[model samples]
Target: MIRIHEVTRRFGDTTALDAVSLDIAEGEFFALLGPSGCGKTTLLRVLAGFETPDSGTVTLDGRDLLALAPHRRPVNLMFQSYALFPHMTVERNIAYGLAREGLPRAEIRERVTEVLDTVGLTALARRRPQQLSGGQRQRVALARAIVKRPRLLLLDEPLSALDKQVRAEMQLELKRLQHEAGITFLVVTHDQEEAMSLADRIAVLDAGRVQQVDTPVELYRRPRGRFVAGFVGANNIFAGRLLASGGLDVPGVGVLPAAAGDAASGDITGLVAVRPENIRFADPDGDADAPLQGTVLDISFFGGSSRIAVTVPGLDRPVLLTAPGPAPVAPGARVALSWHPESAVLIEETVETTVETTHG
Candidate 1:
């Protein structure tokens, strides 16, 4: 387990981590997800003792992690570059750390062989980094890291170097390795889908501050604020004020019904976000409960699914709808977008300023 409390790191005028705190449970696959310059990697470095925080403390299994040197800490960081010695064969690369630790030759060989088997690279152990494929090289790097048997493993974009197919393969591979190794994993990545698919829980970051931390399903379905709603996935956002009748009233659109927990009693103005998949296409002249009429702008196909963009009156951006199978409507056709009230998520308007303050 790892714990970070009020950790802050800054570089001149820019702050990389702003009083961020988090907990990683034992054997949990946790992910730090955000865009570039969001401090996810900086925070990972702080945990690894490669970077020091301006304030606050880091503890692993209740030990003061910051007090120990990088190598002394019970943790291993797998860098994005793989960082393998080009001339060293896979076996040597994996044995490098144990050898440096002055372990006996027999012990090193045994551990190296065991880890090579664990990572499914026993056959490639004789090959050097240059002779192996990118995925094999990555396995070499991972085998090298895990051979030391650290209590925690830090992965910094571990799959970033692999091709798309290989990356997808390694995503599942990484999870299997973690389960087999029984070491807690804290991975840092900017790819949302990667985090969603690989991590048990994710901490979404932005502008040097923690935005939201939850399961991928929870974060996607019930985003706490506008930034989260916008960043986690594609959403159609409408600015409006909350009405007493359990709905949101917008200047351009009528009072739209709110999702279960979205409605509040007083006068509150905010943005209402609806996922594209939640919206359905209907005939403009049909007798639906409530529909927003719009002109179909375009349709895009993605194998099994399709996305339709609709231009509605009084809205600056087009509304997007995701549906299965072929295109439902062609461009320049009039359509209506409909969804259940439970599909909408209301995000308070002041969340932007609050996020700004925390990030600053």
Candidate 2:
């Protein structure tokens, strides 16, 4: 377990962490996710004792973690480069930590063997870093970090070096290893999908601040703010003012119904975010009339699903919708888009605030 309270770190004029606080449960697979310059890595470094916070408190299992030195802390950091010694064999690299601590040769060998088997690198134990593949070297690096059996493990973009297929495989592998090892994993990554797939809970950071912390399902389904809605997944955003009639009067587009409890009683202007998957194609001439109509501008096929971009009459940007299988209509075809009122999320617009929709 870990607790960070009002942690702030600054370098010159730049603030890396701005009074950030979080609680990580024991044996929890937690992820710190954000884009570059968002301070996810800085936060991880602070936790690892690599970087000290200007003011705050860090506690691990009720002990003062900030007071401990980097080596004395009950934690280990696995770098993105898989920093294994080139001259050392797999077993030697794994046992280096224990050896530095002056453990007996027999105990070091036993621990190294156990860790190699745990990471499924026993067969490659005799191979050097240069002699092994990237994945093998990564396992060696992991083995090295975990051989000490620290209470907490810090992984900085652990799977970023691998290709798509290998990254996917390692995602599951990391999850399995975490469970088997029963160590609390705190991973720092800019990849949203990776965090969602691997972490039990994720803390989304932006501009040195924590935007939202929640499970993958909760973050996707109930994003707290405009930035979170746009960042975590694909969402169609509409800027508008809330009307007293329980609907949002979006300029260009007509008023659309809002989810209950989203619209405030007084006059409030904000943005409405709707996931692409939540929108359905409807027939204009059918008995059930949809509120919005648009001309199909483009259709993109993505294996089992298709993305349709529609150009509405008054909307500035094309509305995007996702449907299963092939696209139902060609470009320039007229179509109606319908969505449930409950699916819409209201986001208040602020002068200094902007949403980053680019996926990590």
Candidate 3:
């Protein structure tokens, strides 16, 4: 288990981390997720003992982690570049750390062989880094990190260098390795999909502060703020004032039904966020009183789903809608859209926020 309390780090005029706090469960796969320059990597480095926090404390199982040096701490950092030695073979690369610790030759040999088997690199043990594929080299790097059996392993953009297909494969591989190794894994990633798929819980960081920390499902379904809602996935946001009748009232778009969560009274400023998949095309003849109407602006097909962008009358941006398979609606067709009242989330934050640096 690890506890990071009120950690702060600064770089000249910019604050890299500002009063960030988090608790990572033992042997849990946790992820620090955010955009570029959001301080996720800075926090990771602090945990790895590469960077010191200006204030606060870091503890591992009640031990003062900051008191130990980088090599003295029971932690290992796997860099993004893999940092493999070109001249050394895979076995030698993995054994380099154990050798540096002055372990016996037989023990180093045994540990290297076992780790090679764990990473499925036993067959290519004699091959150099140049002879290995990108994914294989990644395995080598992972093998080198895990062979030490540290209490925690820090991975910085672990899958950023791999191709899409390889990245997907390694995502599953990384999870399996973590479970098999029984080591706590703390991964820093800018990719939302990677964090969602690999981490049991994620901490969303922005501008040197922690915005929200929750399970992947909770973070996606019920975002605590506007930044979490927009950064986690594709959402249709409607900025308006909260009405007494449990809805959001826009100047031109009228009242949109939303679930008023804990907001007992109305007349407050808020926003309603809806996902594309939650919106449905209503039958114009049957449901004569559809609240929202728009013209289909464009449609894109992605094999399993079709994305339809509808041009609403008063909204600044087109409302995105997703449907299964090919939709029969054309570009110029008029359509009515509707979603369940509970499907919309009422964000009470009044400030305007832009998620320009977010990566999906």
Best by lDDT: 3
Give lDDT tens digits, candidate 3, residues 42-119: 998998888999999999999999999999999999999999999999999999999999999999999999999999
Between prediction 1 and prediction 2, which has the larger TM-score?
A: 1
Clashing pairs in 1: none
**Where does the lowest 10-residue lDDT sum fall in candidate 1?**
351-360
lDDT of 2 by residue, 1-360 (tens): 899999999999999999999999999999998889999999989888889999999998888999999999989999999988999988999999999999999999999999889999999888899998777788888889889999999999999999889889889889988998899999999888999999999999999999999999999888878778878888888766655556666666677667544345565667778889998988877824576888999999999999999988767678888999999899999888888887877655533222222211
Question: Cα-based RMSD of the predictions, in order?
Answer: 3.4, 2.6, 2.6
| CA deviation > 4 Å runs, candidate 1 | 260-264, 349-360
Root-mean-square deviation of candidate 2:
2.6
Question: How accurate locally, in lDDT, is each candidate?
Answer: 0.85, 0.85, 0.88
Can you write out model 1's per-residue Cα lDDT over 180-200, one digit (the tens) per residue?
999999999988889999999
Residue 293 miss distance in model 2 (angstroms)? 1.5
Regions of candidate 2 where Cα sits further than 4 Å from its true position: 243-245, 261-268, 349-360
Candidate 3 wrongly placed segments (more than 4 Å): 260-264, 351-360
Candidate 3 TM-score, C-alpha based: 0.94
